[model samples]
Target chain A: MRSTLLIAWTVLIEAIRRREVYAIVVISTLLIGAVATTRFFELQGLGKFYREIALQIMTIATNLTVIIIASRQLPREFESRTIYPLLAKPVSRLSFMLGKLIGVMAAGTFCFLLFMLVFLAGCQYLKIFVSPPLFAQFLFLQILGLLVVATLSFMLSLMTNLDAAITLGSLFYLLSSIFLSALSYLYQFSDTAVKFILRVMVFSVPQMSLFDLSEKVVHQEVWPPVPAFVIGQLTAYSLAFSSLFFLVAFLLFRRRPL
Target chain B: MNNSSAPLIEVRNLVVEYASRGGAMRAVNDVSFTVLPGECIGFIGPNGAGKSTTMKVLLGFMFPKSGSVKLFNREPGATEARRRLGYLPEVTLYYPFMKAKELLFLYGGLQGMTRTQLKVRIPKLLEEVGLAGRGDTLLKNFSKGMQQRVGIAQAIIADPELLILDELSSGLDPVGRHDLRDVMLELKKAGRTIFFSSHELSEVETLCDRVIMINKGRVVLESPVAELMKPLNLFEIDFEQDGQPQTRSVSGAEKFNATLAEIISSGGRVIGTRTATRSLEDYFIEIIRGHEGSGR
Candidate 1:
């Protein structure tokens, strides 16, 4: 476990030190800064409008960062031949995978925290009345959502190349709401075989929308903070999907020749 | 339990293959050898001759198509086995974002060294590998030779019992190689096992206890360094006899001594005596040439 953390620390340090990650932070700050100062069409101060756009940007940017970071972990290791020296230590393949996943998650969380700060400053400028409990729940669900993305990216990275993994992972995260809706819409007109395939897709592909609390937070007048039972259900649901993806990734990686 | 008498690394009739476009390419074929504790063995071969392939199998980076490999009586790549070993890869590009000190700590920490231990040892290791006072520098700014030095620092950080170095002096300049040789000599004095492959045959001649020469995925010669050097030396007798300069070449020690005595008795003064020894590179090429088309 110590070895695992040590590996994760290296990844985290890289994520923190690499100039590109800071590029994301700078771009995100500018985007949020623009949104905060935007005139609300003809009106003066529409806090919800600014907050909604700000939150969406954070979600999209953070999720994309997570996918990009997670997907490249294995490919970069193999490409640079860095895996030889790393695995040369007492670390196991399983630990290596876990470390990468944890590191991606930690880096993603770091990215999100920076986004959150930017977002809060934007909210302060717009005088947006943020609900403490709803915001906390939103943060919790977003992290769980990020974990699912990280693990899925890990599995995809092993199954394909870096570009394809990032492309697929980002597409899945970006289009998840449409995907869930499309499945239900397609289920009506499909033949038996197509319906069977759709059913398999439903069972296999995680509903990224289920983890999204953005709508609830964006339209705060409609919903309050979620109950504990639902939060528990979301936690279990996310873990089940993450474990399935992680297990598939581990099966593929354990005996692989480095 | 690891028995002290057992071979540190053992391989039997090992074969390894890689998937090429046409089919499986056999990279190592029916190779077998053992490395005992406290021995510095040099694995020398040409490009594409399966030296790296065999090392990969021994390190558990790849699975062999057939036969067996064991390190410390445990299966290859066993975590327990790896903990007792250190490895320097053929291409040594480490985490470039990390400072040299942090990278050493990372490798050492993974192998179960405490931070206190690393903090104390990393400075000394950097100095030993000729990187003193450069511990805080990030690896990206380091030259290829400097990165190779960092690779060496990481490999020996935890001070494992066995060290496996591939292309030991790959990017080192003369001074860097000289420093590395000194460090390796010190390790040898401390009695650590080293198994390495190098295109640099002179390094092998200077450091190896035994040399294993391979060609076309097979080992052609494996012998103790002392015995191999015995027949390779050419003794020369230089003398002035009867107001004439003369030079005589002899093969065996007895003939050389006899020639020397005969020259001395014939009213002669010996000018100088020299022994021209055959280099390992010459011997390697000859053996490799002989082994061509000998593979079954």
Candidate 2:
């Protein structure tokens, strides 16, 4: 565990030093700043519009950053031959994979939180009321979604190059968000064979939409209180999906020739 | 810890294969050797000769297709075995963002060294590797030779019992190579086992107790340096030519004596006479060529 944390620490330091993280943060902040300073004071439902756009931007920035960084982790290490020295030590392959996952997740979470802070300050300045619990839940679910994305990115990275992995990760996220909701609508009219294929597809890809609560936070009139049972279900789903991808990545990495 | 009976590294009929477009290609084929404690063994081979592949198997970076390889009687990837071993790869690539001291501390920590131990040892190692007072410099600014020095420092940071280095003299000037040779000699004096692969046969001849030569993934010859350097049947006769001494090798003893007597009779002044011994380079070439000629 200590060795794992050491690797995690090293990776976090490396990620923090990268210019992309800072650039993403700066862009997110500027977007939020523009929204906060806009002349929407006399507009109806301005708070909802501001909340929706701000949360969407934050989500996109965080997810994009996470996917880019996670997909590049293993491929960069192998391409640069930096993995040689680390593996030459007494560290196990499993520990190394876990460390990378944890590090990327931690870095992603840090960036997400920073963006949230900026958004929240904007909300306060605009006199937009936000329930603290709902905001916290939004942050938690978004981070959980990012975790799923990160694990999938890592797994794809083990199988392909950095660019392909990143493209696949982006497509997965985009398709999951778009197609997951249509599964129920498509199920009613589909034949048995089509239904079976759709079922397989649904079961294979993570239901990332399940973790999205941005709409609820934006429109309080439509917001339903999330009970402990729903949170438990969401957490279990995220954990199961992340674990499956992480295990596949570990097996692939173990067999890799380094 | 002082037992001399057990070999520090042992391999038996090891084989490693990689998947190529032309089916599986063997990188190491039935190669076996041993390194006893405190013995400095030089692994000499031509390019694509499987030296690095064999070392990778021993270091757990690559697995063997068949047979066994062990360090300290434990599996190569076992923590106990890895704890006692240090490796410097042929191309040492480190994170360019890290400073020299930070890199050392990271490796030292992985070896389970305490903070206090690293605090003292990092500087001492930097100094020993000719990078004194430069520990705070980022690795990106370092030249290839300087990076090689840092590689050596990281390899020996934990004071490992067995040190495995690949091409240690690469990317170094004459003075740098001389300094490394001195450091390696010091490590040998401290009873550390060193097994390194190199194309530099002269360095091997000067530093190694024994040399193991491999060609085409097979062992060609393994002998003590002294035995390999023994004088052959040829003799060299040097005589004055254009105010300079020019030497020529005479194959047969009769021809050598006849040439010496002729030089004396002609008053050409025999500057020196000595038996000719094949250097490591010559023997390496001869063995490799012999294998090629045999259709291996």
Candidate 3:
């Protein structure tokens, strides 16, 4: 575990220095900045518009960057053969994969935090009324979603090359985000076999949309009657799936030809 | 602390295979060898000779299809074993966006070397590798030789007991190759066990005490370099004349007699007819040619 932490810390720091984190920051800033600057005339409340745009930007930035960054993370190492030196050390395959997951997640969290700050500053300058805790929950969800995405990306990288991993990871990300929604609709039908298959698929995917309470907050709906339970579910979901993915990734990497 | 100091690495019939489009292709076939501490062993082979595959399996990057590999008598993949092992892959691929310091720090941290240790050791290593002032430069901007130096530094950062270096001089110029050779000699003198893999026979010839030559996934020969280089049965008769020494085709024992008769006839004397002593390059070529006909 000490070794794992050390490895994770190294990976995290390198991720920062490698400008992968900065790339996320610059792109997120641009996204939020553009959205915040957009003029919405009929919406009456300027603060509301800024807050809404900020939330949207934060969500999109975290989701897209996490997928793009994390998907290429391990595949790049494998392709470049940099993983050889690290794996040649006294690190377990599990530790290596987990370190990468943590590193990518840390990058996501840092990027989202930066996005959140920019949004807050924009809101303050615009005198917009924004829900800090609600926004915090949204950021938390984005982090969880990113963690799930990172795990899936790690798995895909182990199974395929960079381009194929990216394509498959993006598909998985899209599916997980809307998986439950698709299942909810499928559940509406009375057909048993179709509903069963949809349920199985939902359970198999990361159930990413479960963390999405931002839409509720945006629509002025009752902001999640069960915040703690939802957080717990997302936490357990991320940990379990991430562990499973790491196991699969490790097996794949162990068997892979160097 | 001689031969009885315990083997740094041990392998018993190790096998490694890959899942190919057609079927499972065995990359390393029932190969086995051992390296004792302080022994500088050369892993020489032709291309696709399973040298890298064996190294990868020993490093736990790839598991064997069969047989057991042990590092310091522990399971090869065990963390304890890994902690003591150092590896420089044939490809000196670093995170291109990372500065030399960041890359070394990452590698040091992975090896569980503390920050304090890194502070003291990194500069020393950089200086040793002659990259003292370039720590701030990103690896991507560095030349291939520079990257190779950093790669060497990364391998030795942890002060591992077992060093596994693959093609350490593959891309280096002659001077760079000499520099790498000097580093390997220094490591060996410091009581570290080193397993170096390369197709360049000269590099291995100068550095290794024992050479294990592999061709096409199997060990073609394994012996002390001195013993392997001992005079072979085939003789090279310089003939005291040039112009492609005349040859007559004959079979088996007749070939030897014909050569001796030619030498005796052409010789105002036998004029130093001696058994062949091949250079490392000649031996390498012979092994490669042997590969063309034999699957192994």
- lDDT winner among the candidates? 1
TM-score of model number 1: 0.93
B1-296, model 1: which lDDT tens digit per residue? 12366799999999998989999899998999999999999999888899888888888899999999999999999989999999999876778899989989888998899999988999999999999999999998899999999988888988989999999999999999989899999998898999998888888988999998878887789998777776555788888988889998988888888888888887899999988767788898888778777753
Interface RMSD of each: 0.9, 1.2, 2.3
Tell me the tens digit of each residue's lDDT in model 3 across B8-103.
889889888889999999889988888888888899886788999898888777779899998889876788888888889987668777789978
Show the lowest summed lDDT stretch of 10 residues, model 3 chain A.
A217-226
A1-258 in candidate 1: lDDT tens per residue?
998888888889988998887898889789878877777553233667776777888888899999999999999999988899888888889998999888889999999998888888777766777888888999999999999999999999999999999999999998877887899899999999999999998978888877778878887777889999999999999999999999999998988877
Task: Note the chain A TM-score of all models in turn.
Answer: 0.94, 0.95, 0.84
Against the true two-chain complex, what DockQ does each candidate achieve? Answer: 0.74, 0.67, 0.52
Residues A120-221 of candidate 2 have per-residue lDDT tens digits of 788878888887778788888998899899999999998888999999999888777678778878988999999999899888889887888888898766
Sort candidate 1 into its docking category: medium
Which pairs clash in model 2? none
Worst 10 residues of 1 chain B by lDDT: B225-234
List TM-scores for all candidates, in order: 0.93, 0.93, 0.84
List ranges where model 1 is wrong by over 4 Å: A41-45, A190-196, B1-4, B231-233, B237-271, B293-296
Q: Distance (Å) between predicted and true CA of B126, model 3?
A: 1.7
| C-alpha lDDT (0 to 100) for residue A224 of candidate 1 | 89
lDDT of 1 at A106: 92
By DockQ: ranked, best first: 1, 2, 3
Q: List model 3 lDDT by residue over A6-95, tens digit each.
A: 556655666566665577667767766776667765444544565666676677667766767677777777678887887887777767
lDDT of 2: 0.87
